[model samples]
Each structure stands twice: as structure tokens, then as C-alpha cells.
Target: MAGNESETAQRLIKAFQQFRKTGRNEKKIAGFNPSEYRVLFLIQRANENNSEMKVSEISQKLRVTPPTVTQIINGLEKDGYIERTVNPEDRRAVRISLTEAGLKATEQARKTFNETILGLIDYLGEKDSEQLAELLFKVHDYFNQLDNQ
Candidate 1:
């Protein structure tokens, strides 16, 4: 079981490395690196859900540190992609939200992500792609369970 898990981990990492190659050629995802794009997407989602999230929330959700989130937020702010606003109810806490430009960038990133995944799905076929997705979810759930244990 351990050997199989190790092999799965290696293959998953290799797959992500290959997937990241798609980002290099994406001219639309300018100014933001892949990680930054991810942060933007998360912020967009959180906003849509009518609940704002702070840098600490982002760090926890993304499994990064508060300092790392702060750094990314700083860059995003400078790029006019996001704004840091103080939470009205909590003056000491601040939330991150996308500016108009940030929302546009997030939309472009979503398009890029969808296109890349669609290309992979076309190559994998519907049946195989579904199976792969299911397996990947199972693997993720398995790891989460282990982490909790």
C-alpha cells in the first residue's frame, strides 16, 4: 500500500509539472504567476459567496503562511488587481477582494485553466477523464483523512 501511495504521489507531481507547462505559454495570464492566479481565483469565489476572507483565511485555505499571503496581496495591490479593505465589524482585520482589473484577470485565468483541462479531457476521452477525476478525488480524500488521523 505504501509503495502504491508513493508511486501515486510521484505520478501526481509529475502530472502537475506537466500541467504547469501550459501556463508558460498563456499570454493572457500576465503579471501574476500561477500561484498568484490561484489566490485571485479563490478570492473571486469567496466574494461571490457573499463572504469575505482575510489573508489568514486565504493562507489557511491555500495551505500557505500568513506572510506568504501578505506578500502576494502586496503585489496584487500594486498591480491594481486587488484591494485590501478593513472589515467593518473588525477594524483590526482586513479582507482581500478583487478590483475590476483583478476580476478580469481572474476570468482570464479561469478561461486558461478550463481550456487546458478541456484539452487534457479531449485527449483522455470522456470515460477515462471521468475515471481519472474520480480517482484523483479519492486520492485527495484519502490524504485528507490521513492528515486528520
Candidate 2:
């Protein structure tokens, strides 16, 4: 790789570091722990299209064990952020859906996170950031395809 490649990789690492920092601070602001924040993010994304998702599917997407996902789900349920429902296709399967409070929390977190990201994107500017996103998506797709293969 060339110097530009190394520079881009370093920039990517720095970007992730910034995201981690902002994410941690955002959780604090939302009165949620990092683990809970992760669960909320996953649930929010799964429901982005207003679709319900199964616990097993969530576990697979998160690359987390089923028991771990269940444990997190239990905590969220207790906190009233989510509720479990039976899958009609398979009564034995459980699905997770965010409650009103959960949706509100997710929206708040998203707003805060987006503001931070938008600031970064502004600094990177329109064309550069779009190019960066395109390149990063391609890289992500490449690795994902390789994993499946």
C-alpha cells in the first residue's frame, strides 16, 4: 500500500476512537450503561424499517451468544425498554420490540450521535466524506463476502 493508504487507515482508526468516546459519553448522558446502549442500538437498527426481529436473529447479527442476548433482553424488559412477543411462525421463538420509552431513548441517542457525526462529516466536507463512506462500504462488503465464502 502507499502512504495515502496508510494515512487513510490511520484516519479510520482515529474515527472509530472518536466514535467510541462519543458513544460512551452519550450513554452516560442517557443514563444507560455501555452494554445497554449496545442492545438499544441493535434493537433500534433492527426496527429501523418498523420490523420486529427475533432474539436468535439479533444474536446472530450481533455475533453474541443467545444467552447473552437473552440476559440483555431481560434487563431491558425490566427497565421497560423492550417487550418480548411470541413469533407466530414458531411459538417457541421469541421476538423483541422496543416500547415507547425504548423508542424515545433510541431517538435521543441517535440525535446526539448524529450531531457528533455530522460535525465530523462537516469537517471532512461533502465530497470527501461521501467518498470515504463509499470506500468504507466497499471494504466492509468485501470482508463480509470473504467471511461468507
Candidate 3:
């Protein structure tokens, strides 16, 4: 890249690093960390589709290993947020679904998260927020493609 390009890239990198740090310090939603919230939401979403999620399905969707998914599932289970059932058709497979508490927690977290995001959009104004979202998605896609290659 040219001199100007290099400087701009450096600034962008620094800005993103700052954002990551800020995110790390942000409060957990509804007493759940990001991963836990995601898992609960995934299970709830699957329930809405008239199905339950398997650990492998959650693992694949989260882009994490089975062990990591299992760890999260274990914690959620112990917390009474989720339940595991034997997949009748395939006795070897386990299906996961949210308990009432889990569903309630997930819904509250989702509501709060969306409200926060909507407030950000309001603060940024519609046009700027839209542009920022599009730009972020492009950045994500660029990295995703690079990783694939």
C-alpha cells in the first residue's frame, strides 16, 4: 500500500483494537456472557422451528469445537437454563432445548441488546448507522473470504 493507505490502515486497526477492548469490558447481558446467550438463543430459535439443536449443530453454528460447545452446554444445563434429551430416532444423539428459565433469560437479553443497538442507531442517526453496518459487513466478508482462501 501507499504511504497514505498505510497510515489509514493503521488508524483503522487501532480503532478496532480500541473497540474490542471496550467490548470486553461491557457488562454481560441478562447475567449471561456472549457465548452463553448465543447458545440459548440458538436453542430457542431451533425450538421455534419445531426442532431441537444437537451439540454438533451448536458447535458448527458457533464455529467452535464440540468440546467448547459441550462446556457451555454443561454450564447452561447446570444452571437450569437448558435440558438434554435423548434423540429418540437416533438414540446415540443428544438434543438440546431451552428450559423455561433459559427462554425467559434469552428473551430478556435479546430485548436489552436490541434496545441498546437501537439507541446506538438513534444516536448515530439512520443514514450513518446504516452505512456503518454495511461497512462492517463488508469488512467481515473480506476477512471471511480471505480465511476461506
Error of 2 at 15 (Å): 8.9
TM-score of 3: 0.94
Q: Candidate 3 — worst ten consecutive residues by lDDT sum? A: 21-30
Error of 1 at 134 (Å): 1.4
Candidate 2: C-alpha lDDT: 0.83
Model 1 TM-score, 2 decimals? 0.76
Residue 28 local lDDT, model 1: 42
What is the C-alpha lDDT profile of model 2 across 11-49, one tens digit per residue? Answer: 989988997886654455366675677788888887787
TM-score of 2: 0.65
C-alpha TM-score for every candidate: 0.76, 0.65, 0.94
Go through the candidates in order and give each one's C-alpha lDDT: 0.87, 0.83, 0.91
Native-to-model Cα distance after best TM-score fit, residue 5 in candidate 3, in Å:
0.9
Better of 1 and 3 by TM-score: 3
At residue 6, give the lDDT of candidate 2: 96
Q: Which one wins by lDDT: 1 or 3?
A: 3
Model 3 off-target regions past 4 Å? 24-27
